[model samples]
Target chain A: MPLTPNDVARLADLARIELSDEELAGLTGQLDLILESVQVVASSVPPETTPTSHALSLTNVFRPDEVRPSLPVEDVLAMAPAVEDDRFRVPRILEEAA
Target chain B: MSEPIFASAADLARDLAAGTLSSEEATRACLERIESSDGDVHAFLHVRADEALSDARAIDQRRASGEALGPLAGVPIAVKDAFCTTGSPTTCGSRMLEGWVPPYDATVVRRLKEAGLVILGKTNMDEFAMGSSTENSAFGPTRNPWDLTRIPGGSGGGSAACLAAFEAPLAVGSDTGGSIRQPASVTGTVGVKPTYGGVSRYGLVAMASSLDQPGPCARTVLDAALLHAVMAGHDPSDSTSIDAPVPDVVAAARAGDVAGMRIGVVTELSGEGYAPGVEQRFQEAVAALAAAGAEIVEVSCPHFSLALPAYYLIMPSEVSSNLARFDAMRYGLRVGDDGSHSAEQVMRLSRGAGFGAEVKRRVILGTYALSSGYYDAYYGSAQKARTLIIEDFDRAFATVDVLVSPSTPTTAFPLGERTNDPMAMYQADLCTIPSNMAGNSSASFPAGLAPEDGLPVGFQVMAPPLCDDRLYRVGAALERVLTERWGAPLLDALAGRDRLSEGGRA
Candidate 1:
């Protein structure tokens, strides 16, 4: 199914980009074209084959469990845009009771 | 003009080691070249002339102390902005990262610094390495040095243009699809995309993590090899880094013989859908290989027809996951929060403002592909196609030692022509994407110029996984033959005629 304008708007909202009307129109056209081309991939390749996620043939790379000293909390927080009480702070998700 | 700016990296290294040329002298020459040509070429996003001089002085001090030198000591090199540099802003040509500075060096940057090379600066690139041309850069489009109005290929265009313009002897570029080879082909420089996991991706800004591989860009094969030798190694920080010995690339490149090599021309990649000039040069390259004792044969990779689609599906899926970490609450830009909304709302607002249209579209497509109801139909099917693509490559390699094709369907297109038409631009990678999908090593070097528009065309050479050394060997041999035929590398041919008009001496 093709994406509706609402779908496009929701995606933009989810992506956190403020799109101007003109930009949204241009992107809508481009997205439609891209979707059309990629649809061929969905339709053509048979179902029996296993999908490839990596180009390299290697598999199952794991590291030994080991503890390493972490950087100081203050040092880590130094780069954060907003921090309070030694933790990252953000806008409240739930509304207050009336 | 001093030859230092345009001289090859190998030559610069030899002179610097012998004290015949000072590192300061070479750095100054590169700075002067950038000062003169960068206004037209727009190859660089930053020029670190002062720090380059300081680094050169350190190299001189090390030489004075009689310390054993690295192979590429004192050579000036450029890095695509996607590679994180400790002090410089590693923007990846996106506005969201306008002031973002990495706290540490990328693995490639660390290795280059250890090798004693002087960094000229970061080159321009497509935002998040998403576009085929550099026009997607928030900073501006990087121009093709051959023709100012035309594009240099992307997301490595800036590096290729720097090599062509003599701004630096070497540059580092990343390849996801044809990001490395396509630009190199159009700009008439040498580009190598090593086998996946051959180079560490520890410090690179993620763009389709599974497909992104950083490699060397230079005017000659040996210089690329020299840089590759230093850059290719295991890094514990990058889980995908291969833990095997790196082949002696310099030695392999210097072996300019393809005798007894079974060279295959990928039937699926040739002929139709290619520019006539590009096809002509590709045929000439094949003929040259045959003349040099290579047994040329036709190899069919039938499933290659589905490569682009499979690639689009898998790459965007991975891109969505990788770019998810860039929410405004983190290191970079933040927007649209008055301390009342939820964390999810803040993330949505930041990403909406931060990412470009192409990136956002892919993320949405990817999210949809991976969504609960659509996983089996879209992303899963794409994965299955990928297996077929790999099988095709493996089957073809059984008959032929290496495969050959044009690096891209066309040479550089005019800037802005395909900028708004995303799929039209995506078609540019038609010939080049399959190799990346298969995790094979590939190289692009100039084939001759196309008389139709006077643009340079490049021929691609591919070898099965871990046979990266062979790509360099065949590339160097064929490049020498072509260069000798044209009297110089293709870029120099244009420069000579271009200079004739400037001096009125032709």
Candidate 2:
């Protein structure tokens, strides 16, 4: 199925990225070509084949449950674009619970 | 200064310890080389000249005080920007984190530092190691040292270019879908992607978590092996790190004996798409190994052809998930942050402005794949294909000690050749991706120059996990044979011709 501009726009919204109309139009064709080419996987892989999440099947790695040093507040805050009161500050993220 | 710039990292280490070369002198030589030629190579995104010189002086003082230092003490090494440095900006070639300095060092960085290697600078790369060529760098593309008009393969292009241009004797790079090996291939350097989980990934800017690996880049096999030895120990900080003794790869490189070892040639990895000159050099390499008494056999990995398509899906899916952290919240560039705009709006605006076209393309594609209706069709199927590729590798490695192929299908093409063609650029990683998917140890060594274009071609060796020594063994043998035949390093032939007009080629 060919991707429409609306599809890309919805994806952009889900990804939290904004795109111009020109970029949206441009990406539609490119993504379509990419999908069409990679669609070979649908035919190539057998349904019963197990999916691999990683190259190695390592599971449940645990370090000692002891307290250790973490990054100091001063150093951590230095990397933040906006820091206030020893924490990261961002634009308003909440609406009233009403 | 001239002699120090072109010396191997191993030789530099020996000279530094013998008191024939001081760390300060060597560090100054590399900085001078960067100052003189980096304008043409565009290899470094950041050169820590003051920090490097001070670090070098400290090492010199330690040596002068009669204290024994590590083997690589005082050696200058370039680091890929993907790895964080505590005070230096780690851009990963993206405007998003243009000037973001991390609070701590990556495991590899800490290891190199403890080993007494001077941190020369952060080398440039494709944005978040996304594109196959360094052209995707937001700062600019890194030009190939051999032919300035051609591209330096990437996203580890800066690391490879540093070694090729003699800016640094050794460097570090992250490989996901052929970033390190492909760049090493075209630039005539050595790059190794150790077995998955072999090297810790504590602070590498995540491109694809599962496939991402940090490895060594150097001018010679043994130098890469020595650097690898320093960085490959298990780090308690990374959960996926393998808790096993690191393989003695330096010994293997020094041994350089491949007699009676069975090397397999993957039938699916070569043929129609391979440039004639690349194929010619690869076959000669195969013959050279045969002459060195390493038995060569042809093996067919039928699932290999579909590896590229599956990689595009899996890699982009991971890219989308990994890059989700870049939403203009705590760190990196923030755009349209007016008080009136909401958090989501600011995030959208920032990402829209900060990300490059290739990055945006992958994010959208990945989001599409992982979306509600399409999950099983694209992302799920690709993971299954990845499993098949691993099984194919298992079957092949069962019969052979290692697998061989041309690192890339062709030599470096002119810059802008594939700028608009994603598929063409994507194909550059074709031969190098299967090993990545399988999480095997793989490396690229300069095979020889391509006769037609007079550019470098790379020979690749893939070994089963934990058998990384085999890669060095074979690579070292080939390097020895090829060096003997050429009578010098391949880059020396193009010594004075590396520069081109600022407008591009002559």
lDDT of 1 by residue, A1-98 (tens): 67766666766665555667776776667666667777877787777777677877666678898998765777556556678899876667676553
Name the weakest run of 10 consecutive residues (lDDT summed) in model 1 chain B.
Answer: B497-506
The Cα RMSD in angstroms, rounded to one decimal, for candidate 1 relative to the true structure is: 2.5
CAPRI band for model 1: medium
| Runs in model 2 lying further than 4 Å from the true structure | A95-98, B496-506
RMSD vs true structure, all candidates: 2.5, 1.4
Interface DockQ of each model: 0.61, 0.83
Q: Give stretches of model 1 more than 4 Å off.
A: A13-23, A64-79, A83-89, A93-98, B494-506
- Docking quality class, candidate 2: high
For candidate 2, give the lDDT of residue B470. 94
Give candidate 2's error at residue B293 in angstroms.
0.3
Best by lDDT: 2
DockQ of 1: 0.61
